[model samples]
Target: MDIGVALRDLGQVDSTALIERVLGFDEQAWVENSYRQKQYDVHTLTESVVMIFTDGKGWPNIEVSKESGWDLLADVAMPLMHKIIERHYPPGGTIIRAMAAKLLVGGVIKPHVDAHPSFHVGHRIHIPITTNSRVRFMIDGKPNRLAVGNAYEINNQKQHSVMNKGKEDRITFIFDYVPPEQLQRMQQMQQASQ
Candidate 1:
């Protein structure tokens, strides 16, 4: 969504629980979901523990489902994701995607807007679990540094990119939400087209 700004700070959040659980996951847990990297080649340098995802393939009627990482991270991840949503977003919205993404050292996600249909209406939120000073996230060509203990909602409709030049990998939990009213209008439009 083009939130009228490049990024909106959603204030701070206690991500200790989620961070601990994510850091403890074995290598296999991270690789369990290769859909992001496989489907979006630009994400090759990143890995994710995806809890839920919706490709918005069946327009007017979206398909959302729990992925393998749901079992592993839901206990700790849900509370954080929900807390942020309930505070800033309205009720009855659909969370199209949720995951903890890792940008490996020296990783570079080239500048690009999220072109998927779901992305147009979904509010993309990001919470930094771990980050170093060397990491830089560019939103609308402006350099922004995301800090831990804070959450931000980025306008996915604008151009954005990330690069991790730090020695350690940068980890951030992200989720996409489509508000109830907007979602309803979106579905209706798609149905009319069909």
Candidate 2:
């Protein structure tokens, strides 16, 4: 997902509905899918309501499926996601992961690259639903502030992290998208292996 840059500002969008929807979820929803936090030590202070996720136990060929959050957020999230995609990405890409991730007040997502094979190719897009001035998103040792209503594509291959020193929790809707060309290449590779 390294677009040869630290951050690519994909401009702004109307996230009012998405924001309202995310705020409606109960506290229990955030903890329902603890996979990200459990697997990555850096995300221990974070909680997520994962909508679509991939089954990539063996790597390369992955299976994507809808999780619990899909029921809660898809109606509002999908339209926004699609709008972003239509404007910024190629048609017919697959979203391997989609979720509303929260960094609790005073939490820090220690700096690290997204090392998974999927992350190497997919675009890691983020839309901040709620953020405070104190939240700093650092990429490669530099601090960048991501605000609400704006979308960004981050280079997940490089070291990146976030720290929420604000009084309110920082929430962002993130998704990993594999453009059609990249997806076709992966499919061919998988078939060749078989």
User: Which candidate number would show the highest TM-score if scored against the true structure?
Assistant: 2
lDDT of 1 at 62: 77
Q: Candidate 2 lDDT, tens digit per residue, 1-194?
A: 87999999999899899899998889999999999998889999999999999856666678899999999999998998899999999999889999999999999999999888899879999999999999999998899988788999999998999999889999999999999998988888888889
- 52-72 per-residue lDDT for model 1 (tens digits): 998778775778999998999
Best by lDDT: 2
Native-referenced Cα lDDT, model 1: 0.91
Instruction: Look at candidate 1 and give me any clashing residue pairs.
Output: none
User: What is the lDDT of every predicted structure here?
Assistant: 0.91, 0.92
For all predictions, the C-alpha RMSD in Å is 1.1, 0.9
TM-score of 1: 0.96
